[model samples]
Target: MVLQRMGSVKVASATLVAALAVVFALTLMKGTYSFGGFWSTEAHRNRSIDLQLFDAWSNPTLWYAPWLDAVGNVALFIPFGFLLVTIVAGRWRIPIVFSTLLGFLVSVGIEVAQYVYAIGYTDVDDVVCNTVGAFLGACFARILGYRGRGFVVTLFLVGALCVLAEMVLSVVF
Candidate 1:
């Protein structure tokens, strides 16, 4: 009974950590809401500026030089993937289907938030890429968790790495 209780607590903690990570990312990028949640719009530059992927992809300059830009965008949402896995599987044990759906919701939420806010724009590619990023991170966490890893620890570590990386990008680039 004690062990079961401890496990449950760990799972809950893991999910909370992931949620907080997402909030933190939002806070750092954009000036959030009046009530204190990380405002996704804080990261937006223009209200409805469309970053069409086809246009971006067509540019040869973006192909190799902006690796950091791509990483920054994708890494920004790893926590969502991490959190979805933790929530559905209880310790990073989520199945592919569950991860996919949750990833989709999160990506959609982000895109919608961007559309609503005057700063950010709604882009389908952002949604697709963000979901893919989260999915990859979740898969990594799930694999490690199978060997008795604690989801909470994974959550904290992943969040920390992302935070640090973003800081570097913001400072240097």
Candidate 2:
């Protein structure tokens, strides 16, 4: 019975990871999947990379766009970090560090892809924010005792169901 339950959890975790990967890809591509060719590469080649740190503090504005963007970037990776840590809980000696590094690499890859595809500009600030978010998520997962396979499976199911419901509702309404 225990072996059967573990197998089920593994299956669920794999499914959740696949779903997360799809979502991440769609998000990084801005929901526009293409196979013909990369669009507007030359036009965006001259775009300047912004390495400025603490942009919100450097230019304090009432609009709050920068702040919101920073927060959004962080929020975007939290679930990814949480899920990653939960999936690799028992196997990894330092799951939090692994999660943070994974987040950094993913963020870097996205930034590079954006620059290459001309879909968006690259920013170091985003990498920092995303890493922090992943770290926080890993910490949260540890606090919640997600080392157990049962808890991880339950969490994934609940999250997946919620996301599905949200998508359905958005389409219906």
Model 2 per-residue lDDT tens digits across residues 1-173: 54235325365467457546644543354424331232332333443467887666676655675776678778767766776776787889999999999989988887777676665557788889988988987787778673344455555556656655554454455
Count of residue pairs whose backbone atoms collide, per candidate: 5, 0
Off by over 4 Å in 1: 1-45, 49-51, 60-66, 90-94, 151-173
Most TM-score-accurate candidate: 2
Tens digit of lDDT per residue, candidate 1, span 1-173? 43233234455355556455554455334543322222233445555645576345556453653454456556655655654554567434436557667667866776666566554556666666766777775776576553333544454556566654665465455
Q: How far is candidate 2 from the true structure (C-alpha RMSD, Å)?
A: 6.6
Q: Candidate 1: lDDT over CA atoms?
A: 0.54
Native-to-model Cα distance after best TM-score fit, residue 144 in candidate 2, in Å: 0.6
